[model samples]
Target: MPVDSKLTASSEKLIPEKQIAGKLLAHYDRHARTLPWRAPPGANATDPYRVWLSEIMLQQTTVAAVIPYFQKFTTRWPDVSALAAADEAELMAAWAGLGYYARARNLIACARAVVRDHDGAFPPDADTLRSLPGVGAYTSAAISAIAFGRRAVAVDANVERVVARLFAIDTPLPGGRREIDAAADGITPDARAGDFTQAMMDLGATICTSRKPACGICPLREDCAAFRTADPAAFPVKAAKKAKPHRTGHAWWIENGGDVWLERRPDKGLLGGMRGVPTSVWRVAGGGEGDSPPDYPFAGRWTALSDPVVHIFTHFSLALTVHTVRAERDCMAGRDGEWWPKADLASAGLPTLFGKVAAAAMREELPCP
Candidate 1:
């Protein structure tokens, strides 16, 4: 049934908030995403620990990628105390392939903080949750609303998009975030806020997507101003993307009989706390970076692979030219690194970029003699 509904606080016309909340909640009751970290819609209470963990993992990562990781982490560390007590190296290894390595570091810090500062239980309010490590505006709001059922407006990327389209806010993001936040606040109901926020997220994820929103069957179709317009996807206007800078570096690969020398990255900058092949400083490509490899970790005969290992990060793309060294077992004595058996390289906690370099450094690709 179509009914006039209030979508934002400052809209010109009058529409009922109850109408919007009722329809959205009804839709959520019928079609909610069954995620590992989520409880049933009307369960007594959701585990705040799981909520916090999932929210942390889901930052800048997709649900599909997070599912297996979430399952593995939950299986290994069943509770907050367990995670707080887990080994940093083991945790970083488990978090190997997941980009944004800083999140993993923050995860450990947040867990420890929760245990030490809050007595192993997550505080229920947004303000208190914000005090914990790595729990920012969006994260704290999500924890509060989803875990505690507070009326905190949790506007993640999905919720932001949904709110932007619901009201047809044509303002570009960053600049328009204030308006979007206000509109999200307006739509958040006084009751069942957790369900309401989750419903909005579901609506954005499943129906009102970035491309070709399913306006015909959307639960809020009647109330959506963008749906009334032909091109609903364009409502959430985004700023133009600037080109990512490019960087080039050299990696030193030392392979003995069947073992490889791996170095742990310094615990400060990019890919920190992960074990990977030794590498030289990364400099911007073409800015004095020539086709020739300039430096090596040790003085030895090195064979540089013709092709470079290319990996993209949020801010830049990297091209690491791998140079392999055939050396004796003790040749890596000067370098503070470990010699791991090639067969167990999978267990090594190499970041994705380094993993690519490692693959290129392997001798397995050649045909058997």
Candidate 2:
């Protein structure tokens, strides 16, 4: 029997779900990417801790960037109970270079929740898993399916692209997400659901890539609506992006005898629970005007530096001017933070934004009086 080369638009002409699943599973059996977090095909399920950790770290971050961090975290804290028991500061420092500091905070909270509520075992069902901190729909589904062998559809960006192309969904995302999820649900097999989900992810990551998808060798090419149209990459249509808002602020660089002033950010909001230099509050333009300067931490001989540190966040861009000051040795006596040795700034666990600020200060060689 021959599969249809061109699928009709009618309901009866929809691509056969079994054929797509069989072909994709066969391809996965041969070409699955050997990630540190995933178990081998037909092997026993992977540790739930590894699965959950990888999923959280991989959010809005590339796998290549996450590999070392994942290895470090697992080596340091192998199990949920260990992670739950770890100190918050140590965990935040370990996660310093990894952006999205909020995730680190939530990771600790979720770990503690798991240890307290679930006895250090992650809930096996998707709905129950979502109740845990920071675990959203996609992550919950992924954990349930991959870690517990439950029948669930875990659609990440990769799987979204693959599904959108498979069905030739022209509606732009997030609008198209519903249709993509539906299509994914329809094709997901009753058995080996975990492998099927991972297979879809692998296919999207390796073959059905966002740019120049290898449609010729794709397992589901015959059933792919986008492949038949000769533009498989045009799918998972996205809405036009609005320009990110820009903001400007200042960071005080107060140094005394080879030590700099650093403070711990509040345990809530942006850069939460991380160490950084004192700075102005980030503000949006009001009535088409720049914001007023924030109050200084303490009066000192402050000199403005020409260079500014520019950092981009998920929702806004920041330009922080560095105000160098030679604070008297006694001035910082009552301050809440430590006077960290300048030589050891690398280990200060500054968020990437503040790290850039430190680099700018170093480049200018702001002398201490």
Candidate 3:
């Protein structure tokens, strides 16, 4: 048979979506990441809650860390209904140390939304799935494709790295995200597209890694433009790193008869609307040191405690020193702030950072680590 020049040209120009899909499927067949969400063949099971929960937990968190948390959550709550009925304080406590409090709040909201609006059923289609709280394009696509077998593209960090390297595009991250998404969409296959998406994730995470990529083991190494050029490391261009801002602040430590007082922060700004220890304004001072105490939540024989708790926010770092005080019996009313017994402190919904500060203060450790 005469050689088909057009087929050859097309193959050279761009790997056909189907073949790209097939190659990845074969790779996955040989080595799929053994995730709990993946349904076993002929198991006859699918839980949207499980899928949704995993996707949410996986955000800004690694799969290895999220697996145990996932196991704990599903084992504890079991389903949307159970999670919906779960006490808010307990939910927040369960979500402690997760960092993002908004995610936890939205998780509860979305769970309730699922129970109320969807009759405890997660929408299988991407469009309908996106309607849920905390769900975005990537999350919706992930849940739809991974759980419901819907054809959709999920562009997460791992997928972004894979696409950027394959095309040999170095537009720079965050800024180059759009270009990466377009390239990913171009290569996405029709059949078993879901598996292909996950394959890309696995390849990027394990083989086409950000640093020290195992190009020799990459299934698509032959087709990778970056690999062919012998500069896979240089493929993903990056922008200059900006210095993170540092803010100075003071967190109040009000103790009364071995009980600690905590407050629910306003529903906006840093740690918005979450339960936390009372804090003064978080800003730097003229001397480049932390600002002075802005006044206690109320007035009394307020004694300043030594040392501070330093926390790093996305935009800035906060070095909060404790200024404890022995308040009088009729201290000012702490609106939304209550005094909880030291023993029962864990029940209230306090942010992990604050919880750590509180625990350290209770221990009276000098300069808490």
Candidate 4:
């Protein structure tokens, strides 16, 4: 039968639920992405550690980018107990460049909690798993269903798009979040609920993409109302977002001969515990009026440089104009700092963005215009 006719039949509850189940299963068998978290054929079970790790990494990150990180973590830590025992510096280093440093911190905290509170076992129930640090409702549902085979409604961005389009739901998300969850739960199957949850995620990520959905290839095309109406993109409506704020700060570029000075940032703010060139507080004004040079007891020529270095945090974009000073080695005694050779800076573990700025400095002369 034609897709439109099938959808029409399904809409009125004329088609048997068994038929829908059969078609969805057949579609998934032919098209599902073979992922690491997936239970291998004939495997007796899934590893909770692997499931938890992948889910955490997948948060706000793509699968392709996450695979290598996931592999590295598992290879190093292997399980919750090992992860719980990871040194703070080692764990943070492993997580560098992944962004969201706080997630890495929470990953360590949750691992330790799992080891301490649950005896190294991830809790099986959604409620219990939700109690773990960084485990939100969606994550809890995903881990519980995928790792423990509990029936749960895992609503990710892709899943949300797919559900909204399938039901022709015109309500704007996240205002529509609740309704969309209901629609997803309506179609969630009982047996292999885990597999069904994963299938939805896969379908959304692939065939039912946010842009240019492949309706012809979608398994649910026969029953997708928005596709028949030729307005699938319109179903998952959205509200316009407010513009992100922009802030300005200054990084101190203190060099003596060929060595640069760097200090470890405090443990609780932006870029916490990361080694960086001493910087002024990032604020609403780009190093606004009254911002002064950092207190350095040593005497040096502080040359103000132009053309700010820009970086985007999750909530805002930052433009940091820097000031550089060439100091004598004897002057290092006046400051609380470490002298790192310009050549050895890379091994000192600079964040990727700062590393770029440093590399630029190496390629240019003073002022780095």
Candidate 5:
């Protein structure tokens, strides 16, 4: 079968599709990474639930970072139905420190969607998988090919780099992404599409790395255009990045008796649906911490700590001023969130930003048991 016509027109490079797939597959049989979500070489595919879960957890996250989380999630929820039935707050808590709060939200939505719309079975077709929550083009393709053995083009960051180098496409990223997609379609084989996609991923991760690709040992080196140029690392040119805008906010540590007041952020924006200490709105500043601190709901004499809690997000950098105040039980009456025991703050599942604030407060004031 021919490649996607729309992408074909934009493709900057063409290769021997069958030969490339065969070489990569042969290499994969001997060196496939022993990941929990994947089947061993020549084995039948693993569970779709495992494929779906691992793909979600791996988004913008590294394998080293995701392994423990994946194990924890599978151990706790087991399957789509169990995940669908999980309490939202508890699930969000379990996902704390995972970063990318939106993915956690979509994880819930996607699990519920799989159970509700597809009868707890993920759809086998890539296009159909795209309809599920959090399953975008790359993710849908990965799941369809890897889990369901469907013929689909899966182009992730790793695959993108490998293809960019193999073809030596010079167009910088974003603009070149379409060309990469087309090139990927050109190489994806009809049989063993899952294994082929995975081989490309493994090749890119272990060999075609960004900075210093090990071209001498790479299985595809002979077929690689950039390798002929002797500078495989120079391919996949990227546009320069702009400086991330700075933002400032204040996290209030309202401790009463032995407990602290914490609230769930609104479920529509950053850090949504997670338990955290009360925080003022986060706004972009030209530079430096913004003019002054935001006011809190409860009234008390506030003690502002000197060191700020700093965190870097995708689009912005944030510096939160930490404030602490002891309050009477009545002062927090009718508040919107729960008063978590200060000693068991670890169980509160605070997002990283708020967790930092809590740590800062505890360091200077009360130490947990």
Candidate 6:
């Protein structure tokens, strides 16, 4: 189906795409936000590595949360070659607090791929960029436009909302994304595709916000379908979200001498490839009296803590019962994990869920290990 280019005005006349683009670009020149990963407007394009790294870190995360992480990552691994050569454990440790461990794992893979396959430089086109690990359509398009000056439509959540409101797209999201993308493609100017993309992002983040949009100051207000109806915020309608499921599990803290038992999680699954204490399988149907103690790594008197550590993931809520026990020095001597010192657990780089469990276990008086 063809996109209706006509604005929602009673006249129903087509708004020139160039006029919208020009107005937006003009607004961008004055109001573009200064970000650590972005070059100033009209400046030379940003490095593809920075663009790619920022995009990955920004996924399902806010800019404020990503800023320090981006700074730390760039400082430690300044370029693709350095990132490619980084030790996996050290890299994951640096990425510990950043939720979504998969991104960190994929970051390592993508960095190595760029160094090995693309000669330590990112591919300049969207299709080629998408071939890299963890680089999806939105990320590939963002890198292609912002890093290599390609004419690509980089529609992130912000751009999606802006386009949805601009066109008064009533279709609920995921389905409406197609119309939003088409509308975005229509306004994407031939020149400064990078700047245009950023402008749309800035407009959405600042003026055309999700809640109360500042339509009076919006550059495209005259051409906006939602604004014509005096209900700009009503657009970008979303479908009702399903209630997230709940699950329960257990983490055992076994201490001997000055070390605690910590094992590396399997290479695939939730919290994969990270070091954590032994835990029971987190399942939906096993929360109440059916929740039984998992097999202990070594025989010892186990004591369950009073409070459970509750953490929320994207799909479900997890309640982790923490159990602690003191064992002999030689207990589980040939186990699959190392005995990490209890004092240095903070630096052990446990994921947030395990970290919470560790904290809950530590509140009780136990032999220092």
lDDT of 2 by residue, 1-369 (tens): 335533433433564777788888898999989999999987765899999999999998988989999999999999999999999988998999888888998899999999999977999999999999989999999999999999998989998999899889989989888998998888888787888989998888889999889988898888888988856788989999888888888898888878988999998888899999989877765536656665777887677779778888888888888888887777878878889899999788888998888888767766545
Mind giving the per-residue lDDT tens digits that candidate 1 earns over 216-324? 8898887888888878888799999999999988988888877889888887799988899888888887777365555876677778788989999988999988888
Residue 362 miss distance in model 6 (angstroms)? 1.5
Write one digit per residue (lDDT tens) for candidate 5, span 3-79: 68757534523438777898999999999999988998766657999999999999989999999999999999999
RMSD of each: 3.4, 2.8, 3.5, 4.0, 5.3, 3.9
Superior candidate under lDDT, 1 versus 5:
5
- Candidate 6: regions farther than 4 A off: 1-15, 285-290, 293-295, 367-369
lDDT of 3 by residue, 164-243 (tens): 88888889887998998888888887666567767888887889888889988888877778988767877688888887
- The clash count of every prediction, one per candidate, is 0, 0, 3, 0, 0, 0
Model 6 Cα lDDT, one tens digit per residue, 148-207: 888999989999998887788999988998898999998899899889888988998899
* TM-scores, each model vs. reference: 0.92, 0.92, 0.89, 0.85, 0.92, 0.92
RMSD of 4: 4.0
Model 4 gets an lDDT of: 0.77
Task: Tell me the deviation in Å of residue 103 in model 1.
Answer: 0.8
**Residue 5, candidate 5: how far off, in angstroms?**
30
- Summed over model 5, clashes come to 0
* Location of the lowest summed lDDT over 10 successive residues in candidate 6: 1-10
Model 3 ranges off by over 4 Å: 1-9, 12-15, 40-45, 285-290, 332-334, 365-369
Clashes of 6: 0
Q: C-alpha displacement of 156 in model 1, angstroms? A: 0.9
